[model samples]
Structure formats: structure tokens, C-alpha cells
Target chain A: MTYTAWILLTASLVGLSCGIIGVFLILRRMAMMADAISHTVLLGIVTAYLITRELSGVHMLVGAIIAGLLTAVLVQWFHSRGVQQDASIGVVFTTLFAIGVILIATQVGNVHLDVQHALMGEITFLPWNTIHLPVIGDIPKATLMLIVVFLVVLAFIIAFYKEWKITTFDAGLAASLGIPVVLMHYVFMTLVSITTVASFDAVGAIMVVAMLITPAAAAYLWTDRLSVMLVLSGAFGVISAIGGYYLAVWIDTSISGSMAFSTGILFLVSFIFSPNHGLMSRVVKPYTTTE
Target chain B: MSVLAVRDLSASYHKNKVLYDVDFEINQGSLTGIVGPNGAGKSTLLKVMLDLHPKLSGSVVFFGKNLSQTKTRIGYVPQRGSVDWDFPTNALDVVLMGLYGKIGWFKWPSKKDKALAMASLEKMGMADYANRQISQLSGGQQQRVFLARALVQDADLYFMDEPLVGVDAATESAIMETLKQLKENGKTVMVVHHDLLTVEEYFDHVMLLNKTIVKHGRTDETFTKENVQATYGGALRWMKEA
Candidate 1:
């Protein structure tokens, strides 16, 4: 496939993965954790490169996961200790992200490490270093990695759907019934970490939050069932991805930002127009009659 | 034999202690009503027994085993307001959570589990509203859904916090019927009840508490005007008498 084709395929995969996983994150009320993880992951990657003297994807993956877990732990610890969760997440992640920016600026002198690229990816150039497999032909390595991450995330959700549902809905009741609510919560945080790490290279940090939360929130507007919400969110994300790429090319804008902007627009539309529990429904309720 | 035993059970919210070294024992098949004024730690004590709250120093034994060890044998129904009713799950979904503990992790509820949950909901007269979203349910129906969730545990012991708080007369009767059935089936039930009038009618045993146990015994012996005065205040005693 051509370079443009490769970028398109990879972007689509990333969108699908983010949407599927984002549904649960939103339902669990940990949407902000995605934003937190994406920010802190820059530090993980930079720190790992400093220690290992290599920029291998695996090293960055390990670093990002560790950093994500640490962020989640700090957030929960602060919450348990009576600190407001949003404040703790904001403080912890901003400090880590600042440290990363300093490291890149000071040490990585040969590399062009701009904040713009760190925040939003340059997807147009990603197809230049495509890797070829025997049966699969030439493929964007990042796309393949994203596919694996997607499969892992889907497996975890499908396997532990009941546990996740129960714990998110009523944790105290689940714990009393011996469901190991804490363990399940940690496992969920780990999954979010993995998802954040998997997508950071392609979508970057700022847009990654959009991919994690926008589709999920949009899906939330459309459905009451968790299963339906998951499927709908994934579909919405893919549509946003394809549409955003073309819009970016037409408008001569950044692909990542365009994609996030499109996703955000969809969220706003859903917020206003959704039939059940939408802002528009509430506004129009007094004038409407129910049969 | 004591079906449930609590020793040196103390609990606190942040810095302020709510339950201090309070201890109690409950026998099998007993309908025990934990009656107390507001802020008397009745709910906290139940939370302690269910290990929902952190304990400063305590141990709870159930059916000759530690409470932790016997978790599967206990059902817990927290207060109606304890949950976010705006959640998107349906009534049946809530009840199916009871089977999650038994099914363990990475496993979905099976056909057999659904049948069991449905049966429990039927017992609570809520089978027809199985697919109804929790937010749409009335206050009494909401309470019934929570009770049905506990009932699906099929536990040997049940801990219910204000199961009758906002329940209608019919829902209350339905809940009382389930509680009576549980007692008949050799299950011990500890209820945190607020209504003073129904204490004698429903409970076989009563524990009057005001941060500490003022009196505990059979309903006829312990739930007297004097115990009410000691536990709550003189006003409650006068109200009970008049």
C-alpha cells in the first residue's frame, strides 16, 4: 500500500481501539485518567530513553505503562487521603509532563522535539518507515502494534465484562459480596495505561484524550446498555477518523487536531440531540407531550 | 450458637470515631432490629460487620468462621441513597451483581444465574420490572430492587440498612414477607430500622444503641420505654408512652 493508504489504515485502527476502550473508562468515571496517562507518558518515554540509551518502542511502552500506573496510584492515594481527585490528577500529571519537556529540551539536542508534535502527531509522515511482513505485505509497524493493543483490550473487556460492570456500578456492594473491587479497579487502571501507551506515538497526548473520552461520551448519549454503548462508540470513532483525515487534507490542518475536533463536534451534537437524556430533550421537554 | 459475633468493633469517619468498642452477638434464624437515634452508629456498625468500612480494632465471626472467610454466605443491602440511581443499569442488572461474587472474575452470568436472579426478583414482586432502568423506578421499587439484589446472594445471613426508608406500604409488606421467609429458612437478618412502631411487630430481638449498646435482648424485654429513654432521650420515651 502507498504511504497515504498506510497512514489512513493506522489512523482508523487507533480510532477503533480508543473508542472501544473509552466506553468503559467513561462509564467508570475515569475519563480524566486517560488525559492524565497521556501527559505522564511523555516523561516515561524520555526517562526510559535516558536510562536505556535507546528509543525502541518496547522501552517506551514499558516506561509509559509504569508511569501510567504510578499516576493512577497517586490519584487514588490522594483520593483516599481526602484530596480532591481532579486536583490530584492535574498536579501529578502536569509535574511529570513538565519534567519530560525539560528532559527532551536539555538532553535530546540532536532531535527536533517540539511541543506541537508532542501534543499532536504528524500522521502524514508516518508511512515513510513502513515494515513488511511475509504474508501481510508492507504495513505501518505502528498500525500493527495498535491492532495488537486493540485485541488485548477487547479480550480483557469481553472476558471481564461482568466484573467491570458490577464494580463500577456498586463497588461497596460488590466488595461485600467478595468481588475484589480493589483488584478489579487496579486491573482497569492497568488496561487504561496500556491503551494510552499504545496510542501515544500515533495520536500524541492532547488528542489522545479526545480519542478516549469523546466517542464514549457520545455513545453515552445514544444508549442505556453498556454493550450497545461500546459498539456505538467504536463505530463513532472510526467515522470520525476517516472524516477527520479528509477534512485535515482539505483545510491544510493537523490530522490529530482535526480528528479530535471532529470527535468533539460529534460529542456536542450528541449532547444536544440525543433522544434519551440529551440536553435538547431536557430543554424541549416542557413543550413536548408523551404518549 | 451465635450465627454472628462482633468483638471490639470500632469504626470512624476520618478523625471522628462513630462506633467505639461496640460488641454484639446474633443467633441463627433471628430477626434482629438495630434501633438507635440518628448518628448513633447503627449504619456504621452494619458497615463494620460487612467489612465495608475500615476498622480501628475489631474482628467479626460468622458461622464459626471469620467474616472475611464467610463472605459468600452474607448478603448486604446498603441504604437507598448510598448508590447513584442515575446509573444506566437496569433492575435485573443490579440483581445479577449478587451472583458475580459466586461466579468470580472473567466470567459472565450464566443462564442458570439469570434464572436464579429472576426467581429472586419474582419473590420481591419485581419480576415484571426486570428490564426497567433503576432511575425510572419509584422509591419503593428502588428499595425492592436492592433487596432483590441481596436476596439473589441466597446468603445465610443478611445485613440491610434502612430497607424500609422510603418504601410504600405494599413494598414494605413485600420486603417484610421476604425477611420472614429468610428467618423461616434459618437465615439470620440484622436490619437497621428507623420506625419505632414496627419494632415490636417485626423484630424478634432488638438492640437499642446510642453510639454504644444501651440494651439488647428479646423484643419484649429490651425494647421498653426505659431503654428508649436511655438510648435516644426522654422525649422518645414520652412519645412511646403516649
Candidate 2:
């Protein structure tokens, strides 16, 4: 595979995994929480590095999961205690992310970790980082991780389709019918955390939020069926991946940053041109163009 | 024998007490209406019994078993406003959620499940709108679809929270009709109702509540004006005028 092919595949997988799980985040109205979780996981990564003295995928993921869940629990606790929702999210993420920054500045002495890498991922290095496997030979580590993460995401959706849907749509009904609403909530959050860490290297921290929320939000405008919406979310993410890659190369810009920009652009286009719920429909609704 | 029983049920949110020592029993086939003013724990009672909220102290038994044990025998119709209408599912699909328990975990709904859901929608006069997205339905139509979903549960007992708050008269009559049919078929149904004027007319058994049960029994005897005033107290001038 050429250098461009590997980078595009990795970027596409990052977009696919984040975009698919992200439909739930958008539907559950937890998009803001997704952003918070993405940022706060940096704290988990830094703390794990401090303890382990080396950054490994498995260890970093475990740390990210623990930190992500902690942030979720803390945000929920504060909101339940009569604190406003946005305020709780803001306080928890900012405090935890600040701690992560402090740890990185103090402890990560001469280490390769830096805020710039975490924020705007250097995707040019993606092709060079290869892992040799038994049958597939040498594959980029990001590609391998993302492929596994994407499959798990697909399995989760396939296996728990009804449970996740009913819970997101109506919690009381889900609980009454013997579904463990709280447990299901945490389970889906764990999936999001996994997707976040898997996609983090390709999209970085800030852009990961864009990958998770933007494509799904854009797809949400086009379809009234969740199954179709899921497919569209992944497709749009791939489109952004493909489009942003060319844009980045053409302009000599950051690939992840360009991809995030593409997602925003797609969202804007969807917001205006969506057949059913778009601004065009709103304006032309009274005219009722019967075609 | 009573189909449902509650004893010493209390639930609190933070430092505030929502329900305290609320106890009640409903006989089999009783169409009991759980009524109270705002914040009287009407919804909280159902939520606690269903384990949606953490209970401070309570005992809820359905058919001589705990909630998890009798879950298949239980169904719930949450408030129409409880769910987002723009949930990207058709009316039939929403109704299909009713049978999620029976379909078992990790298994897709078969043709039989879809037929059951369609049948349930037909009962609510919603068969024609089955394929339509839920967001396109009218307020009353949406309530009817919700009732259809609960019907698909086919449970021995059902609990509903404020199913008639903003629905039109047609939906009100449709829901009341279904509730009556459920009772006639020997199913115990409990509704969290808000309208005080329709208590006696709509329910055979009534539980007038204000953080606790002011009265619980046959509506003719328990739903008297005095009991209602005592339950609502001066907090409701609307009831006084009525």
C-alpha cells in the first residue's frame, strides 16, 4: 500500500468508528458529554503514563475507560444534586483536563508526549507506525486498532440494537420491561470511550469530537430511520475522510484538522439541504412543491 | 387476592422527601387511578416500583414476586412527553419495542413479532399510520401509538404515567376504552391521572394521594369530594371551583 492509501484507510476507520457510535450520542443528546469525555481522557492517559512509565495501547485504553467513566459519574452526580447540566459538564471536564495538563508538564520530562500531538494529531506519522501480524503482514497500528474497534462497535449495535434504541428513546419503558437502563447507559458510554481512544491518534482530542458528533448530526437530518441513519453516518465520515485527505495534501495542512473541517462543512450542507427537516424544506414547506 | 401490593414505600430526591410510607393494594382487574397534585409522587410511585428511581425504603410485589421476577407479566406506558418524538422510528417500530423482552436479548425481531406489533397498532386505530414516522403524528395520534406499544406488552398488569395530559378528546376516549378492555380481560391497570373531574367516571378504584394515600378503595366511596379536597387541600383552587 502507498503512503496515501494507509493514511486514508486509518483516517476513514477513525471516522467510521466515531461516526457510528456517535449516532447514539446525538440521539441521546449526550453530544456535549462526548466532547467532555474525549478531553478528560487525556488525564487518564497522563496518569497511566506516570504509573507505567511507558505508553502502551492496552494500558492507555484501560486508563481512558476509567477516566471516562469517572467523568460520566461525576457529571451525573453533580447534575442530580441540583447543579445545572452544562455547568456540571464544564466543571468536571475542565478540572480533570487541567490536572492532565499539569501532569504532562511536570512528569512527562523529555517524553515524546505533547499537547500539540494530543490536540492536532500528526497523521503523517501514521503510515510509518506499522505492526506485523500473522496473516495480514505489516499493517499500521492505527489501522489495526480502528478495524478491531469498528467491528466491536458494529457487533454492539447488532447485538444490543433493540435495548440501546428503547433506552435512548424512552428510559422508563426500557426499565419497566426489565432492561437495565443504568447499566445500558454505562455500557454505551464504555463503547464511546473505546471509540474515542481508538480514533484519538488519527483525529486527536478536539477533532475526535467533530468525528463523533458532526457526521451523525448531519445524517440525522436526512433520515427518519435509525438503521439508515447509522449507515449514512459512517458513509459521511468516509466522505469527509476522503475529501479532507485531498484537501490537506492540496493545501499542505493538518490532515486531522482538515477532516474535522470537512465534517463541519458536511453538517452545514445537510442543515440547509436535508429533504425533510432542512432549512430548504422549512422555507418551501408552504409552497408544497409537488414533484 | 390483590394483584399488586406496596408497603412502607418511601423515596426521596436529595434532602427532599417525595413519597413517604405510601402503601396501597390493587385487586386483580382493578382499573386504579393514582391521582395527586404536582410533585405528589404519582410518577415517582410508578418509577420506584419499576426500579427507574432508587427507592429509599419500599416493598413492591407483583403477582407475589419482585419486579425482576414478574417483569414479563408487567408493562409500562410512560407519559407521552417522556420520549422524543423525533427518535427516527416509525409507529410500528416504536410499538415493536413493547415485545423487546419476549424477543430476548441479542435476537432480532422475527416476522411474528412484527405481526404482533402491527396487531397492537390496529387495536388503537393506528394500523394505517404504522409505517409513518412518529414525529409526523398528531399529539393525540402519538398518545394512541404509545398505548398501542403498551398493548403489545400483553402483560397481566400495566402501569402508565400521565397518558392523557395533553391529548385530544378522541385519544382520551380511545385510551379509556383500552383501559376498560384491559380490565374486562382480567388485567390489572394503574394510571397516573391528573384530571380530578374524571376520577369517578374513569376509574373503579382511586388512590387520592398527597405524598401519602389520602384514600384508596372503590371510586364511589373513596373519590368523594371531601377526600379529594383533603388530598389536594387549598393547594388547588381549580378543584374547589369544580
Per-residue lDDT tens digits for candidate 2, residues A67-108, read: 899999999999999999999999999999999988999889
Provide TM-scores for the models.
Answer: 0.94, 0.97
Residues A1-291 of candidate 1: C-alpha lDDT, one tens digit per residue: 776777777788778889988887886788888888888888888888888887666787788888888888888888878889899999889998999999988987676345667788677777765677899887766776787788988998899888778788888888897877888887777777777777776788888889989998899888768888889898888888888899999999888888898899899899889987788887877777542
DockQ of each: 0.66, 0.84
True contacts kept of each: 0.62, 0.87
Q: Pairs clashing in candidate 1?
A: none
Docking class of 1: medium
Q: Please give the C-alpha DockQ score of model 1.
A: 0.66
Tens digit of per-residue lDDT, candidate 2, span B75-173: 988888888999999999999999988898989899999999999999999999999999999999999999999999999999998899899998899
How big is the positional error of residue B101 in model 2, measured in Å on the Cα after superposition? 0.8
For model 1 chain A, give the 10-residue run with minimal summed lDDT: A108-117
